[model samples]
Target: MRLRQLLLAITLVFTVAISPIQTDAILAEDMAIIVEVEGDPNKWKAYIEDYHPFVEVIHVYDTLLNALALKGKSKDLYDIDKEDFVRTIHPAQKYEVPNAAHSPSPIKPPKRNVNTPYTGKGVKVGVIDTGMDYSHPDLKRNYKGGYDVVDFDDQPMETLPTEGMPTLHGTHVSGIIAANGEMKGVAPNADLYAYRALGPGGVGSSVGIVAALEKAVEDGMDIINLSLGNSVNSPDWPTSIAVNKAIEMGVAVVIANGNAGPDNWTVASPATSVKALSVGASITEIKIPYLTIPLEDRKLPLQMLVGSPEWNFSKPYQLVNGGLGKEALPDVQGKIVIFKRGEIPFSEKVQVAEKAGAVGVIIYNNEEGVFQGGLTETTSIPVAAMTKEDGEWLLQKGKEKWAYTSYQLVKDKLAPFSSKGPVVANWDIKPEIIAPGVEIASTVPGGYQELQGTSMASPYVAGVLALIKEAHPDWGPNKLKAAVLSTAKPFKNETGSLYQPIEQGMGAIQTEKSINPEILIYESRLTFGKINEGVKEKKVDIVVENRSEETKKFRFDYPHHESGVVWDIPQTFYVKPKEKKHITVGLRVNSRKLEKGLHQGWLTLYNGNDEVYLPYLFVNETADYPKIDGVELTLSPFEQDKFKYSMYLPDGAEQLTIDLYEPESLRYVKTIVEDEEVKPGMHEGIINRGEFVENSYLVFVKIRNGKTYDSFVTEFQNFPLQP
Candidate 1:
């Protein structure tokens, strides 16, 4: 009965596409062979019952037998199978997986919250993937409802016939978003919904995705996480359109930037859609290993994991050592394989050790702390890494047969595989931010596992976005995107090379930076105008205000402008004697936009030359013009000698506020101003000065927002007797 319904469903899908089911040629590439399996239900069942010889079987293209035909075992069957089965069916096509070609795992970027709470507690995040393992402890409590789009079943419950379904890929992906603590997701407080868009084989159709997305939209999801994408590009693809619709309806869509990278790089379809938040990958530190030795050898440290706590190597789990390239490597089939870091892809070395039957793999760094590398999907063994000194000690001790065993894996810091980018193609600035993608400990089916990939990076983003959305319910993708992108510090690569905003797009997404609630910035993102070559000028008004305490002393320096042009903004501005103020910079362009090209440069603001650049992109035109609103300020006096101060300024407010406890002793006190509401061109009184004080105090002030507005201390000496 189930087979009859499945066949009927297949027929309907075939009829819907109009074109004969011309299976994509790429689908054939991964399978070993194509066999003629008669469409008749009896024959298909008989084959499965009597001769189950294939390694991996996929009922692709609705009834096509995608089976692996091994060389020796299937030879006799091929001869007889062709005569009996060939006439009953017929060879359709041939395909095979590329040599060593496999899908890449997108890295989960390391999240950087601006140090505010933004958990999407009441919001729902829908994950469209294979069925989630709802029974898993970490996910069970959060499971709202999920539909197996593949089977048209409403839930991943007992009713669905999952006879030959694929593994739990969807479950793992869902865990990355909604898994409870122990394997906590970024937005642990958010609600979860799932849609099984993929089958057991981690494959799904375009129509299924559309169906799932449409359902999610109807269900009113705040964010939709799509980990699947089409291998081949098609502009009119249904999934792309569905995702775009979801975005139009105020849903933030997070899609995988396709795991096909390191070459021929392009984010897949839905990810490529303008509305989608295409996420890439980053490497992060994960689980740690413990190495035990006698107390006397404490001075000779094993390996140190960065940002990870020290492990008591003297705990349970027996330790043993073996020499490098040794035939029998520490007999680690069920234990952690402790190996020194050296030449070759870490995956290759780990695989060899695993082939020697090692269970868990541990490679210590070649330096002092931890070293980083990527693991292959084919290797299922849990791998933990350490530092170079640890590897050396292990090598030295292996000569002396020191027992070493690691109990758990601890994350030290961000990993190296996490690809950094200022998006190359769109040049729209990609990799909006970095997150904990590599070796992250997230919930897995049945238990916890440390997984890595850009796949992991994206959900961290989705989870964080959920939190931001939770806090600012009014923020749209544009504001959220801008807040995330604009606030990221211009990060430098490992080699100290300045990372362009185009490559590490918008810099790494810093969660800590996104939830500050208040941001001081230039009202306009891109200053626009047209100016003729030679002595042309445009004055862009910049708002300056203080988000923190202390009067601001501001100046713009180190102008990085394109050739054939000279530019200038206000060289200097001030907030107040001891409070934030608003100011503007005047810009003069000496030349016009030449030859219809973009002229780009950086504007660095100096609070004593700790320079940070504000990126500018200008299109070449006949002329250019730039303008900004002037600053607004207001002050109220609480007494004849004391006043409460406040101001309203733009995001790029040139203002700072400072607090002083003592009229004279201003150096040691940790003084700060809390959230103050001041708009451009206005100020209000906030501070109060009372009675009499014996001593004087000093206070320090810095730009809490780090953008346009900043400040310094204004000396308040001993107070005189009130008149």
Candidate 2:
């Protein structure tokens, strides 16, 4: 789910050989970039500045990352990249801050239900996103000094609308962590620092993010919250590595898993950073809208989209298919309009429907599961989203629906939009925890606003971490993370099936329990990775630390029965007071006897009656996921009149080909490349220059695996060369 938006065109500095970290094409025009070096960045910067007059050295990050941020033409950078000292030339990536749609007005912030023992007194929390509105009453008290990488200034302020897309995201996130005025956050007394890495429109690049991280560490930040991320899902990405280094330096990092939800492998960096605490979206107790038919068993559970009013109509209204809700319709007064979600924004669809005199709106999923969406503009009537199944059923049945009307509280449910994970290269359970992200009311620039996404959920956990840090000032970052994970509460879905660890990780945070756990466990969950047919067993070790003065006894609880799985359990044992001991757990599996797919469950460890659940899973052979992703086109610099195309082939393709079609109409044009035998990993090539019959065409990548053949249609306008 890589979001496509118009990005800045700039010069790219790099070697002829490119790393997978780059997604955007290197243009001949001057652009900003980060040049990673194997040698000292300071020395590299000095040498570049002294020798290369064409290149502008922005910043040298030598401490945490040996990289030089620069602005120059791709040609000039390429010449410098010829030196062996340069590691990789990285294109400045557009990292977006995830925030659900927001309304023009503020919502009433919820009051704290219970008082906590610690309020993060004296702890320093750094917010790295769009700069905070320090002028806001709720945030001003805790607002500390910070630098602005976006505008290169000392004042880090949220941009005004005159600037790009005016932002309130960082302010909202900051309020969630430490707002102490009319609205009190989880750690209301903590010191807050703002790093405006993202500017107008909440958009930023990799260099700014890395620079911000370096500055935060220099300022001695105890904890850092990054609600920003890119769609590239790789653990080895520069940002992910940078986060890992920060954690190594004893800084706790909390990041939003992503907004691309319910999909496996959608967790983006640096949330994919193994050491950082990744958080997903979940819900607290709240009532949502539902639709029912008189005699039908299908009841559509609807999420009242943010920036829209509640659905108060209890009576059935006539339903009409709006055909994607992009165009106008006649004779639709007082009827409920149904829209299949795609192409247009939720706000636009709702606005169109509202303007057409529709009483209510239903924008159904373009994908499998239900989604949480927002309207930028508040609508006069209620609007909601349903699952693809229910939406299609309505398309067939075409029935007017009645509302549930009564209270049905959804508690501890995973937000449909929170990204899930078993990270690609090494299978790791991301979002090591979950928190309330649905309609969370927090501080905006002008006042309190309710915005949803893992963005809000991340700060909630960061505030929790602050409280934990205050309670145990002597603990390291890993210990703090372990305490939080071991003491969390796992949730079950409506079907009574516990949500998988990959979906909710250790589940929602338990504030009080995490701050003062009886015992702490490190290496929260065991990820066994992909187990092939021949492999019979796998072993993982977890460290448990006793916090009590007395020795603690622990025993392993049997996992639910799976035909081919056997446990190598340790006998009940006692751990010395305040001692940390390594405990081994083994999973012996007979692959032939078990079903050949993803097999997962939980193993419980008990100390007396209190229990700690550890999650483990492995795929047999390999999961049938897409083998290719992200096809991008750029003009070749070395060749004449040729377009350079790049794509990632995770598992090499048996066959790879590109097909061109007429844009909008989708009429077939011609083939660009048809390779019968394609290699694995990243693939790139320069297309042969040919004459074009048309000015523009859509580009598609057709790939083949064992039994699956899929075509990826991508939007590319006006490839100037041969069509």
Candidate 3:
């Protein structure tokens, strides 16, 4: 009886120990994740591995991001996450290249403005993207040594066909910056360093990007140009923070704002990083097609569909309405067809128009405002898009009205695809300035190709900065940024409304005016963020540095007084040569009297013949921004049992909870994160599968920033443990 009782006790102990973990629990096979830790990395790795046997440390990043890239069994990762030494867990996010043509030269290359244009001589500019064709004649002279984080090698060349998709992006971008042989770059003499973080097919991961930044900073690059970015728009995203840190280290960081534009808040990081020189795409001095009512003096600008032949019309053509462009029209032959955008593919519409023997195709947006579109396949004839209002007016004018084509040739027009922003948390204007990106001709691999995107535009700015750096070697990143922002040529949109601080970002770069700046405008943009009704007065200071060797008098050209806003302009001030003066600008806003939308205008400061315009803007009440962003869930690659989840709180949240539900049945599952206080920035942890039921789950992240509550939803399949 004693022996049997002892055996029963042992059995019970074993059962209790294993009960918390279900055998049939849903688990990850093997997954990659990043863990932030504070103490000694080596000791922490050992401690983590000793406690969680399945965890594997892939790489340790000590420079830019003090974190570890780890792979492990899902269940074990959760156990490791529970330890106090561990901090935030990040999903190794996958990133793809932001997809780029003649971009007219945004600025006349510096040569025309000055006798000896600064070609980035001796300046090291790093290109962090897919590897480049370093051997390309245009780039070879400027190409220097670099690291390949993807392959963990010293050879930072474009991926070979034997490995994956060959890339010419890095080459094109490099050529745009410092190409010296066949075609001239912005800075033909600037030294180029390549960081091949992205691999085949122009796809990579967050860890890779972080690693690239680390390497670039370690290499002591004078200016780092990241022509790549992810869709996350948060200012505190890991890479964005890294960029901010990089700038603090005295290296100028320039990043592509993203290609998902003409909408506000579409800008992506690390362009969202506060100090980075975030660039936007603009057009060069080239004429694009538009439609006119010859005698009416009325014109409808057309945004040519990407992948369609350029619209070239020497004379007017007959017009007909082809409803939706879904069906072929009987009498559309020998005429221009106008189709409503909907239902059918744009290429299909063009094909239909072609079958009807139409001379050209024009697609009018069914919704309000203009839209950018593309054809799946190249069309034989030209096609373009217009606003819904234009469509209605065109249909009202009747088919008998001939559509005469003309060119809206202008320099520095904002590209429809270049992303815009007021960063989520900071509400700072992004793409601080624009450069030409449309149909920009630059070096590819063996030769050259005309590609377009903020990607192409980025190198232009990089080159410009290189030249400026050559001219002003003593300038820091902030000064360099200020030089460009204060001098860029601000312009109005096609609608005659001044581009908002978010949309145009102080306008396009003017090489001649910016290359030799005499004064640096600190915090070049005057932003009064989101003001509450209680906040009647706000003040931001701008430091004026007199770089020129003479004392200069500064005066403010007062903005047109509006009833709602009262300006506190400082009286005339003077700064001695080589001295810095801080001027405080204040605004008293009456919320009740202000309009409902974004209020923005320019304030001009003049010193002698030199002038600097500061763009100021603010939102009256609640700003239009995403409160919750950068939500990610990563499944383990080694085992199937557990997963790591991460989320970013733009502003510290008073209460936060993640509720899980059955995806198909709408059944409430469990709350993983209870109403807990979370601070600003990234928060991540591993979760045990046993906490959830066996069903596909829909996740809802509920957050409260003060009294305001917001929720974001996502879904994933759930796996149950085996009995």
lDDT of 1 by residue, 1-723 (tens): 011111111222101121112222221222222233345534553464456444233222221121222212222333334334432221011111111102222334323333556556887989887667787777788888866655555775311235543345455566667567545567766788888766644555554566567678777888888866653232223455567767877888887655444322233455645556766654444444455555425332232221122334443333334334334454455544666666555556666667777555566765454333444234655555655666566556544444554454433233333333222122222344445555455554545444455566677778877877887788766555555544555556556664543234434566776665234343222243444355555555545434445555668775655555656556776665424344444555545334653344456766544443565444444211111111111111112233233322222234445555554443355444545433333233434434214334444443344343454444443333333
Segments in model 1 whose C-alpha atoms lie over 4 Å from true places? 1-118, 156-165, 230-241, 260-265, 284-427, 520-723
lDDT order of candidates, top first: 2, 3, 1
**Comparison by lDDT, 2 against 3, better one:** 2
User: Which residue ranges in model 3 land beyond 4 Å of their true spot?
Assistant: 1-60, 67-90, 100-115, 290-309, 313-407, 495-497, 595-597, 637-645, 649-723
Which lDDT tens digits does candidate 2 get at residues 565-677?
A: 88887969789999999988888888788776666678888999998888887877777444565455653343435455666566667888898888879898889888866
Candidate with more favorable, higher lDDT: 1 or 3: 3
Per-residue error (Å), model 2, residue 204 = 3.3
TM-score of decoy 3:
0.77
Candidate 2 segments whose C-alpha is farther than 4 A from its true place: 1-7, 10-33, 47-56, 71-94, 99-106, 112-114, 328-334, 399-407, 635-644, 652-715
User: Model 1 residue 619 lDDT?
Assistant: 40
How high is each candidate's TM-score?
0.48, 0.87, 0.77
lDDT of 1: 0.48
